[model samples]
Target chain A: MTQHTTGAYDEELRDLVSRIAEMGGLAEGLVSEAVTGLARIDIARAQNVIFNDHRLDDMQRQVEERAISVIARRQPVARDLREIIAALRVSSDLERVGDLAKNIAKRVIAIDGQFHTKRLAFGVEHISEITLEQLKAVLDAYTSQDLDAAHAVRSRDDEIDAMYTSLFRELLTYMMEDPRNITFCTHLLFCAKNIERIGDHATNIAETIHFMITGEYLQEDRPKQDESSYIPAGYSSE
Target chain B: MTQHTTGAYDEELRDLVSRIAEMGGLAEGLVSEAVTGLARIDIARAQNVIFNDHRLDDMQRQVEERAISVIARRQPVARDLREIIAALRVSSDLERVGDLAKNIAKRVIAIDGQFHTKRLAFGVEHISEITLEQLKAVLDAYTSQDLDAAHAVRSRDDEIDAMYTSLFRELLTYMMEDPRNITFCTHLLFCAKNIERIGDHATNIAETIHFMITGEYLQEDRPKQDESSYIPAGYSSE
Candidate 1:
């Protein structure tokens, strides 16, 4: 009887992990489709990303429900409890990632035909590619409980931030060069910001993985290099 | 012995709720201070808001730890388990709201002495005021488990969204009118977006409350009126 109970609990835990992996896969797909739609100006693909966000949301609910049920039934302690909590945290992050992707996809529909700049599209595509890689790596680290892999994902977020900063400057210059470019470039700017935020969420998931494994908070401050700081020259409001 | 165990579990649950309330209060204060700092350009106040955000983060960790401990100890089922999960979810939302407020405060430091536009500052103040109201109402609803109040908060998010959309247009116009206004208005734009996002987080809390009370997902689609759809005149990329 005790063996049967242990086997059931193990099965439940495995099922929770598998559901999280499925949710991660869906989120990654949405990110890819959203950015691809932007680069290629594919409204149909963008719409698909937007419509499919509900699936991620549903999956997140399922993960939370299952995790909570397991906690109630098993009364898991210490590391076991932390693993259940981690699933909840990771699912929430994945859901937010999906929402961010949907935000980018919406921009594709919003900026349908104002102006198509291949250079700007290329910049966005490049940033999205890097962010997607980070997201994939973190999700893998999460499933495998690889602390080093998670740390690697956390360390690489600065690259996305730097790319976003340069893109911001480039988009600003484009707007200044042509007033007509303002509308289109502004949409692209938002899309880039959304992708950058996805990178941040991936880093968040990495931290959760570390906490899950160690049952302790990460003591180091997260390395952040978002260059949104706009210090005006010769300005002292103090 | 059973009665004594129940009493102890009740005490733990109560402690979790109290910590969440305390965290909510801090998050609310941070929002108020951050926006007030922006309106007055009070760098000191903004710095305080930024510094205090770490406290909210710490509180979130505490809430999670406490909730997990309770679950492990009591093995709460049904409503009891849901209540613990609600505390965790609410604390997470509150922490994100604190972070959003800090993001706004950081903008205060970023755009220190570039160009202070009284009208723009007033606009941000107005939007922040409404968002603060929504947040307070939602937080109260959460504590009381008042579904109607939660729904009211959700319904009011469109007001914030509409305000944000208009503010975005107004800020874009300001930037276009003068290159000098670019840096300042851009910062204000981001601050406004941050406040708008706080409103969304409040809506998220309301949804969590609904789930906690009903044990089911909110079946209705979230009311979203972020009027960012820009259909340029005479444009068709298809």
Candidate 2:
């Protein structure tokens, strides 16, 4: 009788984990679409990201419902219970990360095709690419339950933030140099900030993974490292 | 035997709701203090908000952990399960609201006392007061499971958004009028946007409450109204 119950519980937990991974995949897709939409300034793609947000919201609900159902039916203890709870929190964060990405895309659309002019200088594009890579890594870390990868994602957040701050200062200079640039530069600044925030949400997912493993929160706060990289459009920060 | 088991399940579910209420109070306090810190441009208070963010994060984890534990131990179904999931989602939203508020305070300190010169004609003092009240109302609506109160909160969010939009336009004008105002106006704009985001988070909680009672998501995405002047300074919005 004991063996039968334990076997049933293991199967249920595995089912729960599988459902979580499926939800994570959907979430990662939303972030990717939203960012790609922003980069290409594709209003259709951006609108697609906005419309698809509801699907993620629905998936979040489904994931939580499944987790709760499994918990109630299976009565998991210790590690399995923590894993399900982490999945629940992760889905929530992932949903918000999707929302933030949508916000960026919306801003991209609202700016009315202005980013196309005067091109990005001072590594904005590189920073965005790195932020996207970091987001992908953290999602990978969570779905795979990798603490080392999670830690690496956490460490990289500061670099994205610093790059963003440098971008902010540069944009401010543009707005200052030509008041006509206010509308466009400010929009880009907010877009960069949105990408930075997406990185923070990714860091959040990693921290949750660390907590699930260690049963403790990671202690270090992400730092704000500033940079003064203002050469020409052709010059790289390196 | 069935009667006794159901009765025990009911009591455990009640306990989950009560714990969620407790966490809600803590989150509300964090948002209140964070905005108050921004109003004063108090660096120490701002730092405190950031430092205490972990507590909000921990509380969120605790809420989900306990909710899941109850589910495992009790095996609740239907409404009982829905209530627990609602608590989980609401707590996550509250934590995000706290993070947004802390971000506002961080912007406050980043401005470093130059804020007074560029104060929006709309006034931070006024917006701060309304925002705190909105936070409180949303928490009350959640804990009490009052859908009417929740709807009312939802209605007010549009107002908050409109106020933030107005502030956004004003800040653009200020930044265009004088380059020196860029840093100061940017910080204030961030603070305004943070407050606006809190209103959205509060609305999310209200929607969750509505969902818990009805099992349906909010269908209408109404235009955000202007709820900023609902209460005169030194009075109440009610």
Q: Which candidate number would show the highest TM-score if scored against the true structure? A: 1
Tens digits of per-residue lDDT, candidate 2, B114-150, equal 4346355345556667777887897788777789999
Give the poorly placed runs of model 1, Cα more than 4 Å off. A1-5, A230-238, B1-5, B229-238
Q: Model 1, B176: alpha-carbon shift in Å?
A: 2.6
Flag clash pairs in model 2: B158-B224, B158-B225, B159-B225, B159-B226, B159-B227
B210 in model 2: Cα distance from truth in Å?
2.1
lDDT of 1 by residue, A30-74 (tens): 999999999988899999998999999899988988988788778
lDDT by residue (tens digit), candidate 1, B87-190: 99999999999989998888888767656676767778999999999999998998888999999999899999999888777777766676556667767777
Q: Which candidate is the best by DockQ?
A: 1
TM-score of the second chain in candidate 1: 0.93
Candidate lDDT (C-alpha), each: 0.83, 0.69
TM-score against truth, every candidate: 0.93, 0.82
Candidate 2 lDDT at B176 equals: 64
